[model samples]
Target: MKYVVGLLLALACLQAQATEEQTVVLISIDGFRHDYIELHGAPNIAKIAEQGVRSEGLIPVYPSKTFPNHISIVTGQYPSNHGIVDNNFYDTERKQRYKMGDGVKDSTWLTTLPIWNLAEFQGVKAATFFWPESEARINGRTPSYYFNYSTPAPNRQRIDQIVEWLKLPEAARPRLVTGYFSIVDTMGHRFGPESHQVAKAVKHVDELIGELWQRIHDETEVPVNLILVSDHGMSQITAKDMIDVKELNIDEELFEIVNASTRLMIYPKEDVSADQIQQLEQRLKQKQGNFVIESEQQLAQLGVTDGPRKPAIVLGTTAPATFTTRPEEQRKDGGTHGFHSSRDMDGLFVAAGPAIQQGTQINRFSNIHIYPFMAKLLELELMTEIDGDAEVLTPIIR
Candidate 1:
C-alpha cells in the first residue's frame, strides 16, 4: 500500500514537470520590410516561411512607432487601448513628455496585461531578450528573465544565450523566449531599404535566425514553437527632398515636431488657431510633394490618428518622400516611419511550429488581430479584442 501511494505521488510530480517544459520562441526583427524577407539575405526566414504560414504584410498600429505597436502585438490591443500611442508625446495626465526609455514611470503606466503576465499566472516561465517594455515590471515584476535593449551586442551572442537557457532542466526551463534585432531597420534608415547596407543587415539577421534554428534542434526537442514578427516597416527618405520645419512659419506654439519622414507627428500647443493653420500650410516654404500636412481631423480619418498622447496634427511624407524639423542634424542615417501603414509600409510575420499549419498563407490577418492567435499559441486567456481576427490562420500544422 505504501509503495503504491508513493508511486502515485511521484507520477503526479512527473506530469506537472512535463507540462511546464512546453516552450515557445518569438522573435521580432524591427523595421523588417515585408518584401525583404524573400530577397537578398533572408534564406532561413524563407525556409521557415516555406514550412509555415505568413501574412503578405503585417499591418502596424496607428502612429506605428516601436513601443505602442510592440505592446499591442503581444497584448492584443491598439495603442489607444494599450496606453502607448507613439514614441514621444505629451501625456495629459502627467502633463509631460513620455518616451519608451523612461524605465520606472512608463512601466507603471501600462494598463493592459501582457502575455508574459498571463503566462506567469499559468505557472509557466517566460523570458525575453531585449523586447521593448519587457524590462518594465508591472503588477510586481517583469518576465522570469529579460535583457534591456542592447543592439550593441553581436546577434550571435543573443542566440547563444537563448541556447544556454534551453539547457536547464525541464522543470526549471522557461516555456517562452523572445528575441529582437535592430540591424535591418537600422541599415534601412541609414542606407534605404534598397541599399547594399540593408542587404547586409538582412543577411546578418538571417544568419542569426539560422543559427538559432540549428541550435534549438541540436540541443532539444522539448515541444518548442517559434513565431517571428515585426513591429513596422521602413520607408526611405531621400536627402534632396528633406523638408525643414524650422524654415516654415508654422505655429511654433501650436505644435511640437516629434519625428519626421513619410510621416511626421505634430503635438498642438495649449491653444492654437484654424486660420493660423491655413497660413502655415500656405506659407509652408518648399517644393510641393515635399510633405503633406494633415489637420487633426484628417489624421483621425486616415487611421494614422492617435490619442491623447497624440498631437493635434500630423505631417506625412508621400511615398519615397521624407521630412524633418531639422534636416541637417537628424543624422546621415536619418529615416522615419509613423506613416498610415498603407500597402507601401506593410510589416511582416511568420509562424513555423506545431501550433501552426505548414506551407499555408493567411491572406486576411491584420496588425491588430495577431494577439488572439498568440493567445491560442500560448494557451493563455485573451486580454483585449484582437483587431487581427479578420481570419484565423490555418497553417503551420497538420
Candidate 2:
C-alpha cells in the first residue's frame, strides 16, 4: 500500500514537471522598424525589452523583403538556400511565377524546413496564427493548429486563440506558436513610415501585444516565452524619385522583366543572343540613374547565387528612388523597402520570458539566427543545416 502511494506521488510530480515545460510564442509585426518602440511610443514592447532582451537592430537578409526575410527567420537559411528568393519570382524549373498573396498551396518551392515543421516532426506540437506559408502542408504536415492567412482576421481573436492553446492539457498543448500582424506594414506603405497613421498603428499593435503578454502571464501556469520580430523596415519615397523602366529603351519582347518597386529583375529570353544581352546590359549601365546595376558577383554577395529564379541582371536603387513599370504605379509620397545594406531595412527584435536573460541588450544580428535560438528555447534538436549559428545568440539565453 505504501509503494502504491509513493508511485502515485511520483507520477504527480512528473506530470507537474511536464506542464511546466517552456512554451515559445513568436510574434511578427510586419515592417516594425527597430526605432518604432522608441519613436512611436510602444510602452508594452518597451516593457518587454526592459524585462528581457533587446537588440540594437535586427538585420534582415539581403533585399529585405517580407516573405524572404520571414522565411529566413524561421528556417535559418538565406533566400537562396530556402528557395523563396523574393516575394514574387519566376521559377524556371516549375515554369510558373510566384505571386505574393496568392495562397500558394504547393510546397515544392520551399527547399528547407521551417521551424514549425521541424517541431511537429520531433513530437513537439506547434500552432500558427497566419504565419506566411503556415497554411501549406509542408513535408506532408501542417502545424497541429493554424489559421489560413487572412488579412481580415481580428487581432484580438488571434490572441485569444493563442491563450486558449496554451491553456490546453499538457499533452495536447503546442509548445511553439507563431502569430503575425500586418497593420504596421500596410500603414507604412500607404503613408510613410514616419506618418501619423503608422504611429497610430504602432500604438494599436502594442496594445494587443500588452494584452497577449498579460494573458500569458496570468492565465497559465506554463512558462511562456514571447519573441517579437519584424520582417523589415520601411523608407519614405516619392513619385519624383521613380525610375521608369520604359525610358531605358529595351525591347520588352527580348526579356522578362519584373519591376519590384525597389529593384528591377531582368531575365533574358532563351533565344536572345549573348551579344544582345551584353548590349542591353551596357545600355542599362549607361542609363542607370539613382539606381545601380548589380553584377553576378554582387548578387552572389547578397546570397542570391545562380538559380533559375536568379535574374541575369538586377538594378537596385539607392533609396529615395524606386523602379516602376507604369506611371500610375508610382506613389506621390509613401514608403518602400528591399534595399540591400540599407540601415532603413533593419527590423525589430525583442524577447521576454523564462528562457531569455533579463535586461539584456545585444548588437545587431541577422534574422537567420532567430531560428536556431527558438529551436534551442524549445529544446529541439537541430536536425538540418542552416546559415544561422546558434552561438551568436547563446549569450542571451538564460
Candidate 3:
C-alpha cells in the first residue's frame, strides 16, 4: 500500500510540473473569415496550420456578432446563456441598456464563468489584453492581469507585454493569455470584405502574429500553445443589400428599435397596446420582405429566446444582405457579420503547439467549445458546469 501511494505521489508531482511547463495563448482576430487565410498569403498562420491543428471554420453562435460570440467562446455558453446577446441590447427586465463600451460596470449582466475566472480559482495565473469583458470583475473575479481596451497601443507593444508576462517567474507567470485585434473587422466594416483595405489589414495582422510567434519561440522557456480564433466572418454589403426600416412607415412611437445590424431586434414601447405591437410586427415583416421574422419558437430555434434581453421581434436577413433601423446612417458599401454561421460567415480557428496534433483538419466546429479546450490546456478545474462539449476537441488537441 505504501509503495502504491508513493507511486501516485510521484506521478502527481510530474503532472503538476508538466502543467507548469506549458502555456496557452488564445488570440482573436475580429472579422477573420475562414477563407481569409486562403485568399491572403499569411505564411506564419499557414505554417501553423501546416504543422498544427487547423479547423476549416469556427461556426459562431446565432446572431454571429462580436461581443456575443467572443463571450460565448470564453464562457462555453450561447449568447442567450452568457447574457451578451448583441453589441448593443436593451435589457427589458432591468430597464437598462447594455452596450459594447459599457465596460464591466455591472457584473449582474453576465451569468456564466469565463475561462480567466476558472483559471484563477484553480491556482493558475491568467492574463488578457483587450479581450471583451476582460476588464470587468464579473462574479467578483477578474484575470490576474488585464488591460482595458486601449486604441493607441501598437500591436508590437501588446505582443511585448505578453512576452514580458511569459518571462515572469513561475509563481508570477500567467499560464493563459488572450489578445484581440480589431483592425481587420474595422477595415471590413469601412471597406467591403473583398476590398484592398481588408486585405491590407489581414496582411498587417499576420505580420504582427508572425512577430508574436517568433517572440514566443525566442523569449519564453516554457512550451507555448498558440490558438488563433475570430469571433465571426464578414460578408460584403451595399446600399442595394440593406433593408431600410423607415420604408415601412410604421408609427415609431409604438415600438423602439433596440439594436440593428444584419440582425434586427425591436421592442414595443412599455405602454403600447398589444394591438399596436401586433401591427408594428406585421409592418416590419412586410417592409423587410427578405428577412425572416422570428416567432418565439423560431427565436428559441435560433438560440435567441432564452434570455430576458431578447427583443419582441427578431429579424434575420439572408446572406449578403442587412436590415437597418437607421437607414440614413447606414454606409453605402462595406461588410458586416451578425448573420447565421454558415459558409462565408463562419470564422477562423488554428492551433499550434507542442501538444496539438499536426496537420489535422476539423471541417467545422462551434466556438463555445473553446472554453473546454482552454480549461484542459491550462490544467485548470472548471468549477462551473458549462455548455461546451470539450470532448469534441480531444482528437485534435491530443
Candidate 4:
C-alpha cells in the first residue's frame, strides 16, 4: 500500500511539471508599432509591459512586410534565407509566382524549420490561429491544430478559440499556440496611422488582448507564458507621393518588374545588354530624387543578394514617396511599411510568464531573436540551423 501511494505521488508531480513546461502562447498584432502603447493608451498591452517584459522597440527585418517578418520570427531566419523575401514575388528560377491573398500552401518555399516543427517533433502539441505559414506543412509537418487563413477572423472569436484550446486536457492541449490580429494594419492602410480610425482599431485590439489575458488567468492553472509581437510598423503615404514607373515607358521586354511600391525590384531579361541596364536605371531615376538605388553590397545589409529572382537594381524611397508601375494602385490617405530598416519603423514586443523577467525593458531587439527565446521556454530542441542567436535574448528571459 505504501509503495503504490508513493508511485501515485511521483506520477502526479511529473504530470504537473510537464504541464508547466508546455504552456506558451504567441500572439501577433500586425503592424503594431512600438509607439501605439503610448499613442493609443493600450492598457492591456501596457499591463504586460508593467508586470512582465517589454522591449523599448522591436526592430523588424528589412523590407518589413507582413509575411516575411512573421515567418522570420518563428523560423529564426531572414526573409532571403527563408525564401519569402516579399509579400509577393516572382521566382524566376522556379517559374512560380507568390502573391499574398492567394494561398501560399506550398512548403518547398520555406528554407528553414519553424517553431511548430520542433514542437511536433518533440511530442509537444502545437496550435496556430492564422500565423503566417501555419497552414502549410513544412517538411511534412504542420501545427497540430491550425486554422486556415482567410478574411480576418473576428478578434473575439480568435480569443475565444484560444481560451478553448487552453482548457483542453493536458494530452490534447497545445503546448505552443500562435495567433494573429490584422485590425491595426488594416486600419493603418485605410487611414493614416495617426487617423482616428487607427486609434479605434488600437482600442479594439486592446480590448481583445484584455479578454485573452483574463481568460488565461481565469481558466488555466498550468503556468502560461504569453508573448505578443508584431510583424512591422506603418508609415503614412498618399497617392500623390507614388512615383509612376510606367511614365518612363521602359521596354517591358528588357526586364520584368517583380515588385514595386515603396520598394522596387526588377529582374533583367537574360539577354539584356549592359547599355540597356544603364538606360533602365536612368529612366527609373529620371525625376525622383527620393529614390536610393541599392547595390549588391547594400542588399547584404537587408540579408539579401542579387540573384535571378532578386532585383538587379533595388530602389528604396523615402517615407510618403513610393515607386509603383500600376497607375491605378494609389491611396489618397493611407499608411505603408516595407521601407528601409533605418526608418525607425519598429514593431512591439511584450511578454509575460514564469520564464520572462518582470518589469524588464530591453532597449531594442531584433525579431529573429524571438524564435530561440520561444524554443527555450517550451523546452523544445531546434532541429535546423537558423540566423537567430539565442544569447542575444538572454536578458529578457529567465
Candidate 3 has an lDDT of: 0.83
Candidate 3 residue runs with Cα over 4 Å from true position: 1-21, 325-330
Ranking by TM-score: 2, 3, 4, 1
Residue 310 in model 1: shift from native, Å? 2.7
Q: Tens digits of per-residue lDDT for model 1 on 104-217?
A: 455756767777877887787888888878888876768897887776887888898888877788777787788888888888777777788888888989888988887887
- Error at 165, model 2, angstroms: 0.9
Estimated TM-score per prediction? 0.84, 0.93, 0.91, 0.91
User: What is the lDDT of every predicted structure here?
Assistant: 0.71, 0.88, 0.83, 0.82
Kindly indicate the candidate among 2 and 3 with the higher lDDT: 2
Superposed Cα deviation of residue 258, candidate 2 (Å): 0.9
Clashing pairs in 4: none
lDDT per residue as tens, model 2, 1-398: 99999999987865665456678999999999999998899999999999999998999998789999989999999999988888887765565778774435778788888999999989999999988888878778889999888889998999999999999999999999999999999999999899999999999999999999999989987888899999999999888888878887778788878788888888876687889888889988888669888877787777777888888788889778987766665347789889885668889999998767889999989999999999988888988899999999999886
What tens digits encode model 3's per-residue C-alpha lDDT throughout 1-398? 99999999987865664555568999999999999986866777998888788898999998788999999999999888888888988876677888985758877888888988888888889999989889888889989999988877888788889999999998999999999999999999888888889889999999989989898989888878999999999888776777776665656576667545676677666787888777777776666567887778766776665555877777778766776655466447788888776777899999988767889888789998999987887777788777789898988765
Candidate 2 pairs with clashing backbones: none
In candidate 3, what residue range of length 10 has the lowest lDDT sum? Answer: 13-22
Error of 1 at 128 (Å): 0.4
